[model samples]
Target: MTTARDTILARLGSPDGDPAAEHAALRRDYLHEHHPDVDLVELFAERLADYQAVVHLVPEGELPRALSRALWEGGYVIPDGVPEEWVSGIEPSRRAGADTDLTAVAGVITGCAAAIAETGTIVLDHGPGQGRRALTLVPDHHLVVVTADRISADVPGALALLDATRPLTFVSGPSATSDIELSRVEGVHGPRTLEVFLT
Candidate 1:
């Protein structure tokens, strides 16, 4: 019995009969980063802002105050693995976990594994401080904390720093999509508002 998947696979069989070798033989000539001379932090900020995210450049010493002020409304969740000092003075409404009630929180605060400046994308590996997939997706707002050192010049540069085995989430901007009529909608798949604090 030929299943639908089997039929599809049979029709799309490897053309060269050696996909691995064929891929390895392909020419590869590409720049890893386009603007080597540009400051990654500034470039990342610019690109992030272009994506309609509220970007804040805060000093390390002032991050607590900034975080407190930004999350003053008090309905945010904090995930595990966030540095103690980072949220030392602020209190989150919920602590993210498997049983966390996503509907109760207005937003979530998290840390990213790496950020790509050229693409204005934040990559999350669901590591400590970064919660499970639902924590960021279900909330209406997401406040991401990014350090200057974590900023990469391009996607390749960022990919080099990430572990391939971990589940990864690449957030370019707030959830948005346009239909056939060209009507744009925001917050359709993820947070409607994205705010980033860069230190």
Candidate 2:
């Protein structure tokens, strides 16, 4: 009567053992082996920019202005529902959500829920502050704001911090593809350009 799952479990060890303790031990070992001593936010910014992504740094009070500047430089007009206070000090064109066209937009700016330093990835859970999936995927360029406190050292670190119940988007670099002939192309599925702002 033993099922495949039961067979595997029996072969491995008793399922009655403390799963939480095993998980903690694994996490500790992983962190000790792979965690870097460098500042994650700064390291992530450097790596992202090195991969051809525009990099910026901003404080809490200066985020609005910085975002505005990035949008303007990228040739996008701000939307109406997007608060002026959310992006102040820069004058970009504004369009309605329905009217907004991806082909016309130079870029989209949003916040990231968490950033993984080991893999140089950003995780978005579609939170209110992070905006919708289309905002990052449709535009040719994406400007993501990542706070130092939210940056993690690796994938497991990031997963431990994120909620599984929410929608998650993980971006490592700009969208890219390769042809059968081995010719590489960028911006195939998502933003061709990725810019990171570490604060």
Candidate 3:
């Protein structure tokens, strides 16, 4: 009665693995935040920009207007659960699905679960405003909305807020890679452009 999961675990050399025991074995003394005095939101924006992602700081109650200006062209995909006010005036938005034509859209807009300052990563749990994997991956551009409260000082703090059982997408700027010749290229695996509007 060996299950597929059990077989996979066996292959990985942890057939009888105890989740609690494994977690306890890991070191917990590591410093969670490298710069305690630095503001998490500021640090996050800095790191994201360093990765070549465009970062915008939006004032409170102005997210809707900012979103409209960014995706003004209007062929973008809007996943379910995104706030109505966010996309209210933005017309011609496509609903994402398996049949979505990635080529036809300008990009995808979604909200993030948590943002890590140290790594400048946006972690999405594919819940609510955050869409499924394909909605974000197949598009050429990705525009995310990150709130100030969602910004974490470090990865450890960010992970504490996420659900491990849910599907997670950790985005650090746009998708890119370097070949053996040291030439860099963008848009290989995900969106070529990542624009973040921090509110």
Candidate 4:
């Protein structure tokens, strides 16, 4: 009556072989990232842009101007933890609850935990400057501000920087999918536009 999974468990639980010993027998090291010779910032930007997302590299103090120019349409909203100075010229409507109507806002700007150079993925642990999951999902546009030093070399490095206990959202680009007939549809499930500012 024992299933294959049960048999495997029995062997794994045997006195001779502990899980740690089994793990020790396997190769534990591999290349973490490729082309380490290249600049990490450039790699991260290229990966991010490859996903159909626009990546902006701005000067240290120019985030406010860059954000304003990118979010020129106005009506932008932000999470509570987002710094007020980031949106200097625009009035940002605040949203505290998860059910807020995000589509009404022209864009939603937040901060990311880490950016992956290999995958062009941005990780959000719903931490400070990052609101609930709905904030990024419901809004038509997502504008994320990240620092250049926050870029990780690869997915594993990014994973190491994240807190698994928190809600994590990995966004590579705007929400999009191709239909069966080969037509591409955007914003079907999440934000249609993704903007990243690497300062």
Highest-scoring model, lDDT: 1
Cα misplacement distance, residue 30 of candidate 2 (Å): 3.3
TM-score of each: 0.82, 0.74, 0.83, 0.83
Which pairs of residues collide in model 4? none
Q: Residue 131's C-alpha lDDT in candidate 1? A: 83
Candidate 4 local lDDT, 87-176, one digit each (tens): 674543433234456666666889988888888888999888888888888878899998877788888788878888898998988899
lDDT for every model?
0.86, 0.73, 0.86, 0.81
- Candidate 1 local Cα displacement, residue 26, angstroms: 7.9
TM-score of 4: 0.83
- Residue pair clashes in candidate 1: 80-129
In model 3, the worst 10-residue window by lDDT is 89-98
Q: Could you tell me the C-alpha RMSD of candidate 1 in Å?
A: 5.3
Q: Rank the candidates by lDDT, best first.
A: 1, 3, 4, 2
